[model samples]
Target chain A: MTFFINSVYFGMVLTFVAYEIGLFCKKKIRLAIVNPVVIASLIVGAVLVLGKIDYETYSESVQYITYFLTPATVCLAIPLYRQIHLLKKYPLAIMGGVFSGVLTAMVSIYFIALIFGLTHEQYITLLPKSITTAIGMGISEKMGGIVTLTVVAISVTGITGTLSAEFMLKLFRIKNPVAKGLAIGTCSHALGTTKAMEMGEVEGAMSSLAIVLTGILTVIGVSIFANFIG
Target chain B: MKYLKQLAIVLIVSLLAELMAYLIPLPVAASVYGLVLMLIGLITHIIPLRLVEDVGDFLVENMGIMFVPPTVGIIACVDELKQMWIPLLVAGIFTTFLIMIITGLVTQALIKKTGGES
Candidate 1:
């Protein structure tokens, strides 16, 4: 029993270490898709399951860190604050990019689900997968989703964005920070925003703005469409 | 005086936004409307940044603490999640990856067209 508690500590330590290693790999590997957070989280999650370390215990242990999501998100306003002038300069362009990006994410999921014949519950979960965890989970609840599934989906999407975004952008010949930021937030929400921040301020700011907007639009979009579907 | 006023405004604004969700014929709830309205206020200086400023820093510094109740919620779902494991897992993984690829593609194209700026 004692070993189990200690193992949870090791699990966390490994997660951070793996994340740092992923960061280092960026230079040597020259690959954008293999992000540190993704690699670390996956490695850690797998280890916990394999070790039979009890997910509940581990989560309880790290519950403190997860709570930081609110402040971390609110701090987004700091970056947005810096780029207020930039928004004024190209309101139309930014709005076009972000709204389109948000719609694309939501529609893509809905269409695919329709083709696959997903249940109403699954569709609800899909609705908020593109937004940040807090907002996504909140929306999922309103729409009658399984919050755990939504959270897991959200975390996975976020980690994927953090790890793969840069390389994907480059591979596809993407260079606009605003576009990059919008894509990141629209697809992955808060976790992706962290990586966006590392890229530069404009990317960070645009990503933050996208997070807030994506949540609003997605909620509105889902509710309206779900109404018609019913 | 300050916190009370801020709380009042948040409550009122959030309520109005919630009302809008019904009027606008959308699937989303009122908090979302409140969020958008709040952002607009901040953007236009209709609401001062000062109001949400301290709230943010405090929240960030304490993020890890907020995830407890939810994490516990996930734990309690062990049996239920297992029952629907296949679909949930498949949907979670499939949709996340799909959204990432397509959105990245579309945005990359848009950026190229927009001259990759602004």
Candidate 2:
């Protein structure tokens, strides 16, 4: 038993199993809140806590899975490439929408943190909340924010986008597929992109493009905004 | 064989992107550089899409699972989360809705103004 728990495969197996369970729940429940990543994280967290296993032991092996995050992020270019024509066609709209979205995300979080009297560390942590975890994590770490808190905040932001995107789009009477995708991706990154993909191919493509652009824009944006609290 | 070849290309591109990121003094993540390089490669025909499409698709499709470990780190910050839950929740939920609405409205309005497809 000890040997099995200490093996390199332990964490990988745990993560894969938890994720599969999460996928199963999503399939069965068919609810946006039944997020696979969230569920898997909860299950894995519970195991680490309840089993008296420290996070380091579990994460050492699980790091292998995260090793793919960078490569996976790079592969986002494929979808963006497939949708390059849309970018050319609506360059102004897409670029404008993503820029404003990134701006709103940063500015709004700043004010919210100020109103709530959050410390600078907390403020910076939430600054990159709306982007994908891969990019958001790096920004948070660099800005001296708590990386784990940033991860939680990002997941919360994503789940909120996934949960509310369709209703929000409909309420706003946002009928354009491109706009729908851009909005979701800009606000929630790839998690919301999943919802956009279900909306339509164009929405999915546009959403993926928004993810890349929003990430780049936020990288530039945060450097400037980190000084706001300092 | 095909998948292996495709995986190799992606790994190489990712490695090169990491190298570039290391050499460049910027706040940008290596993943961002990798994505940009891949886009440039596809656009210029320097690296054909077919060379990495299958593996790329697989990676993107299963991307969410990759975040699990990092998120599980939240356990380490339980006390901070307890202290900051309210602000975090308000900021997260409120700003998310605000960004979606504002961004969607702006994009939709711009598309109309630019006379693109409605």
Best by lDDT: 2
Residue B41 lDDT in candidate 1: 74
The residue ranges of model 2 lying beyond 4 angstroms of the native Cα positions read none
C-alpha lDDT (0 to 100) for residue A220 of candidate 1: 77
- Going through the candidates in order, their DockQ values are 0.20, 0.69
Q: Name the lDDT value of residue A199 in candidate 1.
A: 86
Instruction: Judge candidate 1 against the unseen true structure and give its global Cα lDDT, from 0 to 1.
Output: 0.63
List the candidate 1 regions with Cα displacement exceeding 4 Å: A1-30, A228-230, B1-118
Task: Give me candidate 1's TM-score against the actual structure.
Answer: 0.70
lDDT of 1 by residue, A119-213 (tens): 78877776677777766777788778877788766665666666667767676655767667777777777677777877888887787777877
Q: Count the backbone clashes (under 3 Å) in each candidate.
A: 24, 0
Docking class of 1: incorrect
